[model samples]
Target: MSVKIAVLGAGSWGTVLADLLANNGHEVRLWGNSAETAAEINDHHTNKHYLPDFKVSPKVVATLDLKSTLAGVQAILFVIPTAAMRIVAKQVAPILAETGAKPIIISATKGLEQNTHKRISQIIGDEFPAELAEGLVIFSGPSHAEDVATHDITSLTVASQNIGDAEWVQAIFMNDYFRLYTNDDMVGVELGGALKNVIAIGAGILHGLGYGDNTKAALITRGLAEISRLGIEMGANPLTFMGLSGIGDLIVTSTSVHSRNWRCGNALGQGQKLDDVLANMGQVVEGVGTAKAAHELAQQHHVEMPISESIYRVLYENANVQDEINKLMQRRGRREMDFQR
Candidate 1:
């Protein structure tokens, strides 16, 4: 069945996903805050700022009116940045209530709330109706918007507490080139997606510092370990870290040039100021904010996330990136196979 969906956020990922859904025969309405952006997408079928030289599906419509986007929609996908998620959700809740629409809420955005350190689903649950919040589905994995826009072989996980909801999402998104697997571990999936960006930034820093494959490999591996440690402490299944949202996400984000977080970290590693790097990138480097959340979460959970801590210091404290790296290297070493405990 063809489902009518609303994709919030006009960023690269949102545009790509809305286009994909349109191409899949679903009626998709992409909502953007900027009228100019909506006009460009509607008139030209191109989000030039985000996806230059890439054409969007003509079947997709862009809208500035949020209520219209929600009308008769079967599902809503939130791809906005974490910082803006609450504001958007607050604006959306009353509109949904007024319109009497109860679509399946899906969060593709990754990152914990700044001070509360709540996951994206928690943020949504805080603002939306109870039923929608309880059944919220998360879509995450190693797929990049740029690659997925080109119909590249991309696979992701759609996780929900409700298997029926996950299967519904999987069915809507699955195609020859785009594939999705269902997992019940929402905590693991969300953390895997959100936390990997921090590691990817570290990977970028290593790349920018002229480190080779061996260093990258070590960072990726150790990054997964710390992420898993914190994730496990938060009640997520340890094994979920080995799956698509976990190791799969960590590997791709930390290694790929398509990663904005990696690029942001690379710029920082090359000695660019955080503000300067973000201004030049023209996109939200999620890891920068996520690093702060990770730092706080580690402290809250009494978990030691050395790499994440270093990255956090570099991003937030104006600490010398090289000095932080040196500190990480000089840290006391321990057993590598201690996760099973």
Candidate 2:
């Protein structure tokens, strides 16, 4: 069955996903804030600013009109940044309320709200009514836009409180190159996706500081432990952290050059100012914001996340990266398998 879908956000991930859905024979209306991006996608089937050297699917219609984009769509996928998630959801709420549309809401953006420390799904739930938000699905994993653009084999987790909704999303997104698994642990899935970005920044710092494979390996492993600790405290399943959205996401984001968070940390590690690095990236470095949220969450939950705390300080408090690293090394050592503090 063909589904009509509205994909919000016009960045690299959004464009690639819209093209993928169109290729899967769905009617996809891609909405972006930029008129230039919309015109380029509609007229030339290209988004040079975001995904240079790639052509968008001509079948996908790109538009700047949000109301038109949501008209009669059965599903809406949000790929925007976390900072914009609430505002966009608020805008969509009134439009959906006017049309009496209860579309399946899906979020691919992975980051917590900075001050509130709320997940993407939580933010969406706050804006939309219960009927529309009840079956909210989260799409997340180790997949990157650059890899997905080239049809690289990738697997992701689609999580929803309602299992049926998750399976439906899995069916629409799964293809030969793109595979999705359904999970019921929305909390674990969302946290795994969002928190991994913070750890990836730490990984990038290690690389930028000329650390070798052994150090990165240690960082990734220990990073997962801390992430899992906070996640478990926040009502997430312990096992979910071992799956695709957890360890898998951390590994890829930490190592991949395509990761904006890793690249941002690399620049910071190499003595570049945070502002300069963000300005040069031309993309949202989710980890920079996520680090702060994670740090706060850790403090609130009384969870020991030294690595995330150090990264947060380095990013926000003008702390020296090397000095933070030294602090981490000097911290009291404990059992490797101890998750409970």
Candidate 3:
């Protein structure tokens, strides 16, 4: 049974997902923000702006018109950047409801909404009420666009407000190369997606410092602590942080050279400014936006995430990056093993 899947934001993530569905026998409609990009994808079957190396599926329809793309869409996979999530949602919700009927909206995006600190699901709930909107689902994990596009054996979690929602998503998204698991913990899944970027940056800084394997391992382990603490304060189940979405994502992002955020941080570690680093990077670095959101949330919730706080300061407050690193190393001493030790 072929399904109609609309993938919003023809960026790397969206392009990869659209290709995945199309290859799996589903009709995939890719909505790109720019007309030129859309035209290129429609004709060339490749997203020149993003996923250039991966040959797109001929079944994928890349379009400039959102409504036409959403026509008969059963599920919409959101691959928009974190900053644009709300804006895209607002524009998409009305058009989706009006274009025949809106599909079950699934956010594949990661990161807290800046300033407001809203999660992706919260943004969806606010923009599309349950009555008018299809039930929302979130798909996330250690999966990276580069690896996923290559048909790597990536595992992911599909979570929603309820377990049934997750189960519904798991059924459609699971495939041989991509293993999908269901989680009832939306906060945990969202937090895992959002917070891992921050840790990846930290890992990059450690790599910049020429730190050994011991230091990198420590950063990932402690980074999970930061996510768990902050997520719990924000109403997510504490245990969710220990699962695939949490520690799994952190390990992958922090270690992978393919991570945009890690690459950006590596540039920063080598003495590049934020703007210059971003300008040089060809793709979106999710952690850059995520650091700001984490900082704002830390202040609001009073969670002590020194590593996240340090990265936030270096990223936004004009604090010296190396100086912050030294400061983190010299923090009030305790045992390195347990939380609050």
Q: How do the candidates rank by TM-score, highest first? A: 2, 1, 3
What are the per-residue Cα lDDT tens digits for candidate 2 across 91-145? 9999999999989999999999988999998898899998878899999999899
Candidate lDDT values, in order: 0.91, 0.93, 0.83
Which residue ranges in model 3 land beyond 4 Å of their true spot? 99-102, 132-134, 335-341
**How displaced is residue 242 in candidate 2, in Å?**
0.5
Q: Name the runs in model 1 displaced over 4 angstroms.
A: none
Superior by lDDT: candidate 2 or candidate 3: 2
Among all candidates shown, the one with the greatest lDDT: 2
Worst 10 residues of 2 by lDDT: 332-341
lDDT of 3 by residue, 299-328 (tens): 888888999999898888989877887898
Distance from true position, residue 304, model 1, in Å? 0.7
- Residue 259 of model 2: what lDDT? 92
> Who wins the TM-score comparison?
2
lDDT of 1: 0.91
Instruction: Give a tens-digit lDDT track for model 1, residues 42-145.
Output: 89999999999789988999998898888999999999999999999999999889878889999999888888999998898899989888889999999889
TM-score per model over all chains: 0.98, 0.99, 0.94
